[model samples]
Target: MVNLWTSSEHALSYLAIADAIPHRTEGEGVLLNQVPKTVRRILDLGTGNGRLLSLLKIDRPQAECIGLDFSPTMLAAAQEQFMGDDSVHVQVHDLDQPLPDLGQFDAVVSSFAIHHLAHERKRSLYAEIFACLAPGGVFCNLEHVASPTERLHQQFREAMGIGDRPDDPSNKLLDVETQLQWLRAIGFEDVDCYWKWLELALLIGRKPTV
Candidate 1:
């Protein structure tokens, strides 16, 4: 259900199973390496449980980070995870809406989240991310993308241990190439799919320093 994320129990269950998703760390690590350690401000979109933001903060301790998500349960969990730490601020916002005015960020990141949006929204969000970045800033998305064929999709489902379950209705999976093209078209430089294994992928791009 689209509204399932609003449930604390559902959100916690996702967190419980989050770590068991195969090769996730590898994609996350690649994303980490792409973000500059000297980053001053960072924004995490659809920041479920603040896990990715927490990882970024480990390398950039002084960075001011914003974790934005619409889910009440996720927002609560993220806020609790960073409570009393002024450096990380968790905000409640829906990605289905345009990004709020949070000022510029040196890096904008997301993980397996954007695919929940429609393709048009995904493109619009990329443009918004580009506009929200400071010149030369980076965008890294560890994403769940569509497989080119049903057989590959089935294989991916098997690998993720979800062989029989029907596809999630919230998922509006797009292919890797189209997303890369969208990033470049939105004025992001150095756009590419950096790392991928089946449906899981690391899509990266950088804003030009113009």
Candidate 2:
């Protein structure tokens, strides 16, 4: 319930160590690979600093991208990331609310975000995502998921060298299986966790072409 992302200090602290999270790029790579190179329009949810959007643009340079985040600090950073790119638009949006009418997208992506939402909001957001996608479109979320046991959770904290630090109160992680099932129930086809490393996982699903 407590999200510190709006605080500049919290946002900056996260950016300071954003790249140091182990195996993060590997999950990102898998996400990038899953999205088709021919997608013309993409939407990035909770797009902090536009890192994942930047990666997505690498291969799909012609794709028009919209990156959404609520934090001013993150919005500024994301704007800076795509300053001169007319094809990329970064805007403010809170994940707790229903999505605005942004039209359909060929692909919808998120990374290391969304877990901040409460569980109910998370499920609703997944349904919203389904509605926003074009037929045959893809939705990929590279997320921080919950561990099965307290022992495993502690091990994950130790693995990330965050055992000494307090757990992020903003995080509302759900297990990967539950999320995959939610996606499936929302009418997504081929829903699955495409890649994983401890608590880091990539959940992907595609709208049926018909």
Candidate 3:
């Protein structure tokens, strides 16, 4: 219930350790592989500091990218990340609310975000993501998911070297299976947990071309 993302300190702390998260790049690589190079547009939800969007632009240089986040600190950092680049735009938007009318996208992606939302909102957001995708488009979410048991969760904490530290109060972690089911019920095809490393997992789904 305590969303500290709005605080500058919380945002900075996350940015400082963002790259150090174990196996994160591997999940990111898997996400990149799911999206096609020919995608005309991309939407990055909760695009903190635009990290994922930057990676996406590596192979999708011509793609028009939009990164959305509500935190002022995050928005500034994202803006700085894409400065002098007209193709990438970072804007203010809260993931807890309905996504703005940004038209449709060929690829919708997120990383290490979305879990902060309440369970009901998470499901609704997945539905909204489904609505925003173009036919044949894909949704790739590299997320922090819940473990099946508390012991596994504790092991994950220890693996992350944070066993002694308190859990992030902001994380409302949900299991991957429920999310995959939501995607399938929302009419996505080929829905599955494409990649995973302990609590980290990549959930991928595609819209039908027809």
Off by over 4 Å in 1: 1-3
| Clashes per candidate, residues 3 or more apart or on different chains | 0, 0, 0
Give the poorly placed runs of model 3, Cα more than 4 Å off: none
- Candidate 1 residues 96-117, lDDT tens each? 8999999999999999889989
When 1 and 2 are scored with lDDT, the better candidate is 2
lDDT (CA) per prediction: 0.92, 0.95, 0.94
What would the per-residue lDDT of candidate 2 be over residues 85-142, giving only the tens digit for each residue? Answer: 9999998999999999999999999998899999999999999999999999999999
Candidate 2 similarity to native, TM-score: 0.99
Model 2 ranges off by over 4 Å: none
Which should have the higher TM-score, number 1 or number 3? 3
Question: Which pairs of residues clash in candidate 1, taking residues 3 or more apart in a chain or in different chains?
Answer: none
lDDT of 1: 0.92
